[model samples]
Target: MLKILPAKEIYLQGNEHAVLLLHSFTSHTRDMKKVATSLHAQGYTCYAPLYRGHGHTPEQLLHYQVDDWWQDVVDAHQFLLNEGYQKISVIGLSIGGIFTLKLAQFEKLSQIIVLSVPIDKEPAQLKQRIIDYAYNYKTIEGKSASQISQEMEPFHHMALDAMSAFQQFIQATMQQLDRITVPIAIYYGERDDASYAQSAETIYQHVHSSTKQKRGFENAKHLMTLGRDQDEIIQEIIDFLE
Candidate 1:
C-alpha cells in the first residue's frame, strides 16, 4: 500500500490578518499545508479548505461540477468573515487561482496571490490531465494494473459535458479579470508548460489592480508551492503580503 493519507482542512489562528489558501484541481488541502504553516508562523491566520469534490476518489470528484466547487470557495470566504476578520487576503493555486479571481470580482479582498493559474483559455490537455489524475489516484488506492485499467475504462470515453463546463468556467473568469482591482501578485514556474507563462502575463495585463506583479520561479514547476523553490516562494509571498 502507498499509505496515502486522508486530506483535511487546515485552520491556524494567529493575528487579525486572515489568509484564505486554496488548492488546485484534483488536489487536497495538504498541498497547501507548508504555505499555510509558514504564513501562520508569520502571525497570519490561515485557512485551507478542501473543496467539495476533492480529497476523495476521482469518480467521486467527477460527480461535482465547477459551480459546486465555487460554492465551497464562497463558503470558505464567508467562514473567515464570520470569524470577525476584517482583513482577508487570498492565496490560490491552479484552479484555486481561478476561484480567487472570481471572488475578487465580487468581494473586497485585502490582496490576492495566484500561482500557476491558467488564464488565457481552457488548456488543451485538460481532459488528458483528468485521465492521468484518475489513473494515478487509482494506483494510490492500491488497485492492480488490470483493476485500474478496468476501472478507468469509463473515463477514457467519459462525457465532455464536464470538461465543457470547466472550459466555460475558465472563459467566464477570464472575461471578468478586469473587474479585479485589489493588489495582486502572480507567480508561475518557468519549468512548467509554456502556457502558464502566457497565463501569468495575460492576468497581469488584464487585471485592473493598481498594484500588481508577476514573477517566474526558475526552478519551480506547475506545483510551485511544493516545488524546490517553495521556501523562496513563501518568502516572496510574505514580502508581498507585508
Candidate 2:
C-alpha cells in the first residue's frame, strides 16, 4: 500500500449500515474525508479505501492497471461484508463515481451517490488536457510551477498508460450502466469543465433504477465535494441515503 500523506485511509466503525467512499482518479482518500466524516458522524460505518496506484507519485500510477483500482473497491466491499454490515451505500467522485456505478452492477448496494461522473466524454481528450496542464504548469499568484505541482501533486496528472487504462474503464462502465438497479442520486456541476453538464442527464436517462434523483449545481465545478456548496451536496447525499 502506498503511504498517502496528509490524509490516510479511513475506516470508522458504526452501525450495520456502511458507506463506502471512493475518491476521484488521481485523488487520494483525503478528498473523501469530509463525506466520510459526515457519514461516520451519522452512526454509519464508513470505509474510504485508497485505490491502488493512487495517493502516490504520478510515475507510480503508471505501473498499475484500472482493474487494480476496481479490485481495491472489491476488497473493501468484501471487508465490510465480513464485518457483518448488512447495508452498504457507495458515494464517489468523477472516475470514482464511474467505478461506483460499475460496482453497483454486481454488489447488492443499498444506494449510490454519483458526483460529477464523466459520461459522454472522451477520456483521451481529458488525458491530453492533463498533459497540457502539466507541461505548461502555470505560476499561481506567486507560487512557482514546482511549488504548485508539489502542492497539487496528490490530485493532478495521469501517466499515459494509466490514462489508457482509465479510458478502458470508462468505456466498459458506460456500457454497463443499465445494470444498476438500486436507488441512485446523481449530482453534477452545471459549469463542470472536467465532465460535461449533459453527462448527468445521460446517466439519469439511461440508469435502470426506478428511484433516481438528480441535482445540478449552477456554480460548482467537477469536484463537488470540495466545492463551495459542499455542505449542501453532503446534505443531499445524507437525505438521499435516508
Candidate 3:
C-alpha cells in the first residue's frame, strides 16, 4: 500500500452568499480547496462535493457514469438551498463547468464562473486522457508495471462507453447555453489547449446574460486554480462576485 490519502468533500460555513465549487473530472475536491477556503475567508460559504466514484481508486471511478456525476452536482446545489443559502454562485472547472451550464438551464443562479470548459468534443483526446488517468492512479497505488498493464487491459471498452456518454452530456448542455441569464464570467488559461479559449468564447457568445465577461491568464494552464496565477485568479473571482 502506498498510503495515499483520499480526498473528501469540503464545506466551510460563512455568510449568506454561498459558493458551489466543482472540481475537474478524474480530480478530487482538494483541487478546489484553496479557492473554497479563500472564499470562505471572505465571508462566503463554500461547498465542494466529491462526485460519485471519485476520491477512490480509478477502478472505482470506472464503475460510475456521467449521469451519476450530474446527479451529484444537483444534490450539492440542493444541499446549499436546504442550508438556507438563497444567493448561490457556482464556480466550476472542466466537466464541472459543463454541469454548471446544465444547472443554469433549470435552476436560478446568482452567478456563474467556469474555467477551462470544453465546448468541442475530441473523442480520441478525451479517451486517451481517461486512460492516462487510470494508469496514473494505479501507479500512485504502488502497482508494478506488469500488474498495472494487466489491470488496464479491460478498461479500453469501458473508457469508450464513458467517453460517448460524456460527449452526449456536453452536447446536451451546449444546446441550452442561451437559457442562462445570470451574471456569467468565463476564464481560460492562455497556456491551456486552444479548445478552452474557444469554449470560453463560444459560451460567452451563446449565453443570454447581459453581464458576461471572459478573460485568460497568461501564467496558467488547464488547472488555473493550482497554477502560478492562483492568487490573481482568486482575486479576480472575488472582484466579480462582489
Candidate 4:
C-alpha cells in the first residue's frame, strides 16, 4: 500500500534515495499523488511539499512569490537529507518545474525532471497559454476568473520583493546549468501553449549534465500531467528514471 504522509512529517524509505514531487502553481500536493505513487513504487521515498500559496484557497496563493516556493524545496531537500537518504531526485510540473530547474543546478541531487515548466509564468510569447492556464485554473469545474482572481490577485503577479529574485532565478539557473552534472530530463507537450519549449531546449544544450533528455507528446497541451497523454508521459518518465 502507498504511504501518504502529511506535510509536517518526513516519509522515509530505509536504504533508498528520496524523490520529491512538486506541484504546479495554484495546485495542492494531491495533484502530484499519481506521479509520487509511481516513484514510491520504485523504492524511493517521495514527498510533495505544498507550495506556500497553493493547495489552499485562492486567498493563500496571492501571498506567495517565487522565493517562497523555492524555500519549500529547500526545506524538503533538507528534510530528506536529515532522513538519511543520501541521494535524491526532483520532479515538478509548471511553476514547480521552474524551481526544480533552479534547484537542479545546485541542489546536487541525483536526478531532476521538469514537466512543462513555468520558465516564464508571464507566458511572454505564450500569452494564449497563460490565458488558458489561468482560465482553466479557476474556471475549471465552473469557477470563474473573477472568483479566482479575487482570491489570487494579490499574488497574480510576481511579488514586488521577488521580481529581482525571479530574475536571478532565471539568471542563476542559466549560468549554473553547466555546473549541473546529474541526469536531467525535460518532459513537455509539442502542442503546449503555456510553457515555451525553448526553455527546455536551452537547458538541454547549456546544462553540463551528460545524461539529459527532452521528451514531448505531440498531442498533449500544457497540462501534460492530466490529459489523454498522461499514460505516455508517465510511461516516458518511468522509462527515463529507470
| Residue range with the least summed lDDT across 10 consecutive positions in model 3 | 154-163
The TM-score of candidate 3 is 0.96
How do the residues 117-224 of candidate 1 rate in per-residue lDDT, one tens digit apiece?
987444446667778889998887888999999999877886777777888998899999999999999999999999999999999999999999999999999999
Number of the predicted model whose lDDT against the real structure is largest:
1
Total backbone clashes of model 3? 0
Q: Give the TM-score of candidate 4.
A: 0.78
Model 4 CA lDDT for position 173: 59
All candidates: CA RMSD (Å)? 1.4, 4.7, 1.2, 5.4
| lDDT of every model, 2 decimals | 0.91, 0.80, 0.90, 0.69
Estimate, for each residue in 197-234, the C-alpha lDDT of model 3 and write its tens digit.
98899999999999999999999999999999999999
TM-score-wise, the better of 3 and 4 is 3
* 1 or 2, greater by lDDT: 1
Which candidate number would show the highest TM-score if scored against the true structure?
A: 3
Candidate 1's displacement at residue 138, Å, is 1.9
> Which residue segments of model 3 deviate by more than 4 Å?
none
TM-score for each prediction?
A: 0.96, 0.84, 0.96, 0.78
Q: Identify the superior model by TM-score, candidate 1 or candidate 2.
A: 1
Query: Which prediction has more favorable TM-score, 1 or 3?
Result: 3
